[model samples]
Target: MRKLYCLISLLALIAILCTGAYCQSPRTANHQPALAASNDAQRTADAREGQRILMWAGWIIGAFFVACTLYLAVERRRVVASKDAELAGKSQELLIIQEQVNQTNEELMAINANLESIVEERTLKLSKVNCELDMFLYRSSHDLRRPVTTLMGLVEVSKLGFDENTAKYLFSKINDTAVHMDTMLEKFFMINTINHESTEIGEVNFEEILDSVQHSSLVHNYAEQVQFDVVVEPGIRIVADPQLITFILKNLIDNAIVFRCKDGKRQPVIRIEVRPVGNAVGISVHDNGIGIAEANLSEIFTLFYRGSEASKGNGLGLYVVRKAIEKLNGNITVSSRLNEFTCFHITLPPSANVQIQTEAAARPVLITA
Candidate 1:
């Protein structure tokens, strides 16, 4: 393009120089006749006309070249604009990709934080379970050994010759020890059953259950002296593991009988009430027993927690009660005042068609001595 411009410029310059030469050549000529001068003047006039034509041609060519340059410049600007638009689009895409990457990173960070929190929570739960298991094992071994050792000693004493009355007394003591051991073993069995067995949820006849419990060996002897007042809501059934409910009731009733005040100030009475509390069956076992002291309330439900010196239990009754209640997705709360009365309230939730309760939990209690 530069070469073309230079060529056009050169041609214009040549046209201007040729016009000047033609206009001066007539002046440089020697003095001549009028006719010759006139002829020279005529040649000059023709040269001037030719110069004008060349000049117009140069001007036209220059104008055409300028138009072409303007067109080329416009085309160059359009190409640059197209390239700028494409680059701008790519930059926008890059920015969007960066934003997406940032969002992904943020999500990953949040997930990581949540996982950390979950792991920490699980670790704490595992630690607590381990501690409880250890405590359970230690206490269970000691309790089992104590009864076995006593029975062994009793057997050795029986081997020694004794009077008939002494023999009877020894045998009776032996029988009592054996019964206590059996009760402890049964409690252990229940514990194992509750822990290992999956819940077999079904409809339970509360009335039939009450009849059986009242007739059981554990309650029959106590019934002779202690009054049992049982009030069950009519036509009400419980949807739960019957065995678990039976276990819970059996323990509570037994505790009511065993822990009764023997001072004879007030008659020993146990009131068992079953009624509906919201969507669940609420069972309350209240006894006018030598009730729990205010201080022992919190420890009563702990494994191997023996709240009273008069307690003949293996210290697993209330613990097993709580565990069984939890297995059935129930809640239990205890209220007691020393030498007055003790009340244990239990709420059992249905397994299906309703939400189960969180767990067995005691309320603010004045509990066992």
Candidate 2:
């Protein structure tokens, strides 16, 4: 639309120029005859009149063009002012957003600092609590043992003065209760002393440990009726605390017998196998008794955790085993099927032949008299 208007304006200007030139050219050609007389005056007047009309037309056109230009300039300035105002408003908004971002960053930094301080405080408190608990357990268990020992001795003395039948019943009850109390206290003492202790790495014969444990726990009395296979190769010797190793095996064997199947048709079996792992020995106690549920296997080593279907126990056997194994820098794993079988794999470092000989030489003499 603007292009068509400009083109028409240009064409009108060209036509006016051509008309002015043509009129001037004719006047110039007839100049001498016209200017020598009165007729010259008339021609001059006519020329002045044409000049006046042309000047008036030029003034009107120039004024119209100036008015249009002024109106366009005013409109352009208004548009520019409006756009500048909008830009200023956006700039203010950006400043507010920047301030908000800075505030959020400051809050985040403060939160992180607070969290770090909280973690440090909790860690120190936890360490102190653990130390206090260990000290308490050690002192408490030791203090309780004196009274329990005195009571057990008195009971034995009282048994000798009474009739045989009455004394037997009373003595049995007293022994059982005292033994249970001692075991509970001993467990606390064990937990307190077991951690961070240096392990005595010696040649631990699994067969010997099993035999001693069976004799002591009376698991062998039930073993006669059970068809269990103990497959322990003689050369397998693990590096661990010998007494602790015996304790662990005794607990495992006791658990096996405690949950033995009572089915008359299918005979119960408990297989104890020791195999050589790299730089260690793997002793597994596999029992075809009342197997543990899948969910209970992980919790079996937790202190005082007894499963729903488990037989009555203090639930410290596996916990004790784990503590002892950890002291020896070993690990234990478990796999089980419900009512089918359960296997516990304990891996411990193997004692070298030189260390075994050294241990043998360090034995003390016993006075048998």
The C-alpha lDDT values of all candidates are 0.81, 0.70
TM-score, candidate 1, is: 0.74
Name the runs in model 2 displaced over 4 angstroms. Answer: 1-171, 185-189, 218-228, 263-265, 349-369
Candidate 2 lDDT score at position 337: 90
Q: Please provide TM-scores, in order, for all candidate models, with all chains considered together.
A: 0.74, 0.50
Residue 118, model 1: lDDT of: 94
The whole-model C-alpha lDDT of candidate 2 against the native structure comes to: 0.70
| Predicted candidate 1 versus true structure: per-residue lDDT over 1-369, tens digit per residue | 567667767876776677666655644465567678687778878777877877787788678778878967987799999999999999999999999999999999999999999999999989977887899889888888988898899889988878999998988988888888888888899989998988787667656787788887778877778887777665565556788888888989888888998988888988888777776878899999999998999898887889899998888889889999888777899999988999999987765522333334443222221
